[model samples]
Target: MTTYTPPQRTATLADAPAIAALMRASVLELFPRFYDERQTASAAKHIAAIDLLLIEDGTYFVHEADGEIVACGGWSKRNKTHAGDGDAADDDRPLDPATEPARVRAMFVRGDWTRRGLGRAILESCRLAAKAAGFTSLTLTATMPGVPLYRSFGFTEVERVMMTTPDGVDIPGAIMVKDIDRPDSIGP
Candidate 1:
């Protein structure tokens, strides 16, 4: 069994670039097996999709070994998908602190780090961070290769998300959600 060292704390701003590069490597190398080249290159690149998501909301986190980045993940207080309120202009309400949820925006680990449990560490870290930030549930859009990993973390299928890239390419993804802190139970 491979032993993985867990991170000490949440990621700092300096970790963003390395996190982005890892994301790029993951998408470029792993995504092509499941998604088209266009989707991999346009929508899944590190700087384009991940950098803004991380630097803006600052939900991104990273795990490093010997000063080298190994794993990363993030969650956001805002929902990136449209709420489908019938009116695209429906009164946009700020997220409710009690019931509103945050989302897992991106997650990745270096190729050499696979099977070392880095992914699980990152997922647990994201869940703990989101819970500490007062979020009850977490959501994320997963690519095909990520389905098993997300499922192992107790995420369930929600929907298929169709997204457009900066180059106007359509990227297909699976939507999954998980309640981090509470286990599913019947009402008493």
Candidate 2:
């Protein structure tokens, strides 16, 4: 048996279509466990929206296994914590590192790749990058299905929130935060 190689590099505009597809698949496969059909559809549509800013900023990444994107996620130093395509406005302004925590944004793993350490790897990458950018803490708005993974990364739930889709449906989510004092690891 051979070991699988993890994704190593920043995302680019060329990878947008594949990454969007991965996000949609992930949401459809994973959200059903915690959401109803209508909500799932709304969430899936939202997840499918890819923000090119993250790629342009070199903060987004895609994991390729056999030349296909198996996972995608990223961290952001901007004010927008989370939003999909049409949901977000033109807010790409940088946040004050002196006062604001780095935002962990757009984390998604293909359904076939779940529980395989990909998500954790992407998260560790985010943490290290954020810390290097002078952020002492990090924050993320995690969907209900994503809460467990964030929790395992030592992120504490600050509050329960609802992510509204453009259709006015509210998807349950948690606003979780974590500091960067400890060593970050996804485990071996």
Predicted structure with the largest TM-score when compared to the true one: 2
Clashing residue pairs in all predictions, respectively, total 0, 0
In angstroms, give how far residue 34 of model 1 lies from its true place: 0.5
lDDT (C-alpha) at residue 72 in model 2: 88
Q: Identify the runs in model 1 with alpha carbons over 4 angstroms from their true place.
A: 6-8, 46-48, 52-58, 81-94, 183-188
The Cα RMSD in angstroms, rounded to one decimal, for candidate 2 relative to the true structure is 1.9
lDDT of 2 at 97: 78
Between which residue pairs do clashes occur in model 1? none
Instruction: Write down the worst ten-residue block by lDDT for model 1.
Output: 82-91
Task: Give a tens-digit lDDT track for model 1, residues 1-54.
Answer: 546575644677766677667777877777777777777777454223453544
TM-score of 2: 0.92
Candidate 2, backbone clash total = 0
Candidate 1 structure, TM-score to reference: 0.79
Error of 1 at 105 (Å): 1.5
Candidate 2 local lDDT, 1-188, one digit each (tens): 65565766689999988988888988999999999999999988875578888899899878898888998889998988884755446357798877889898899888888877788888888989988999888899889988988988888999999888778888889999998766555443
TM-score on alpha carbons, each prediction:
0.79, 0.92
Candidate 2 residue pairs in backbone clash: none
